[model samples]
Target: MRLEQITYFLSVAEHGNITAAAKSLYISQPALSKQITLLEQEVGLPLFERQARGVVLTQAGVQFQKDLQNILKELEHAKKNAVLAGRAQKPLLNIGCFDGSYADDFLPSVYDYLKEAASGQKLVIHKCNFLEGHEYLEKGKIDLWLTLAPSWQDRPGFLKKKIAWRKGALIYSEKLQVGKKENPTWEDFKDETCVLVKKSQNPGMFQHTLDTMELIRLDEGTIEVVENIGTQISYVKLGRGYCFLSENIIHGSKGLRCISLPGERGIEVVAVWSEKNAAVTNLMENYPI
Candidate 1:
């Protein structure tokens, strides 16, 4: 079977709908359906039970999907190795990460280490939402995922290696138009507007901090959906409101103060990948916290 066909099948299996898979693949629904039909005929079994809402994998389809995943992963590994051997500039590893200073802090060192180890390899960073990063990893769309804890739920065949731990820090500009301190506790900011980075960053860790301290009545529009670290910092700097960030962000900022969240269980950063990637084992050992 063709690799493109296999890719289309897997995408449909992952998304459980032809339309979603078509959108993801940047192809039309009719073409995707025709390919799926061709694949099913070649396999000599009805792999999916078609339904009005979406297709469900038949028993055979479920089994085939798993086997197909294994085969595709092996092929991808082979391709990566061949690409590494032939590249002129540098062997590359595409890494996905959450946007912010977290990536800025860790990626530089990681890149340095990989370059030193490979003698000439280059590491490329693709900033993505935490959930989307994991999804891409599962789909073989990325080589690595570096993200905060709680962005993931257990999935078969995936592995995560914890790298660094940092408490969420409440941060605000010293010259902000409101708020009492450089760093306010969850309680202090609970009543005022609070800007946040993204839902993928996992706000639950801070939820307990707010609840335990009896901090309530978070104002409407308090939650600003920031796209990146720079945006969050800009919001705080512009006196828009406050935000919670990794301690790394406030580490050396001239006027930024970082207050530890009450109690521990602070966020942990982890490097995640599929176990099938041969590079993962070696890279895991070399990952810099």
Candidate 2:
């Protein structure tokens, strides 16, 4: 069916009255009715049933409308993106990030690179959590995802590159001498309650450290687990307990003592993108970090 016919059909379906649809479309009711009738003939089925008060979509019309709506949305998105791509001197760059350590380690380099490459193009950086970033990437809404989460081996048609890895340390109040930095152990916290950042699907570098170290004997009954990092840090700052964080995070945070564990691996930073986004990824990769 023609786009006009689809538009007429959708308008009528929305208004539930041919007169109202015709008014909204700036067309006469006869013209609107003629188009709807032609559309029904083309499909060889009645699309709507008229009632005294209004109209309702037939079973076939209901299914057809659902599919048509999806098609229309995709077509509109493609048109918009095409227009944006055509007008740009440089490609539009949309980057999604989770938290601060990434901002500290990789962002400066990525920013400088984009500036040199985008010379005149638009750059959009959205600071969002993992779930939101992943959703945006899957929906073709973003060009790059820089995060501290592990690579997804099962996900297809994506490029995953490791930028850097750094060990993590438990940070506590420097004012308190609860344990020595050289040999900080669980034994040090035998009777003391410690603060922990809540578990998450897309954990940062310090996630594994927290998971491995605390799993053995975490008196879950005693551990104060807060979902927000800001709250976790605040509790640790008050000397209520200590929390795990990447060395990079430690460097950025103030008034905290970073105690390294003897045998733990640091967090890993990765740059991920869809295969279709190679141009943007290459632009990011070749740019100096």
RMSD to the hidden true structure, all candidates: 9.4, 10.5
Model 2: weakest 10-residue lDDT segment is 201-210
Candidate 2, residues 131-167, lDDT tens digits: the string is 6678778887778887765523327887777766667
Q: Candidate 2: deviation at residue 125, Å?
A: 1.2
Instruction: Give candidate 1 misplaced runs (Cα > 4 Å).
Output: 1-90, 177-187, 198-221, 252-254, 286-289
Candidate 2: which stretches are off by over 4 Å?
A: 1-91, 118-120, 151-154, 175-186, 200-210, 214-221, 284-289
Any residue pairs clashing in model 1, and if so which? none
* Winning model by lDDT: 1
Question: After aligning candidate 2 to the native by TM-score, how far in Å is the CA of 102 from where it should be?
Answer: 6.0
| Pairs of residues clashing in candidate 2 | 166-266, 167-266, 205-267
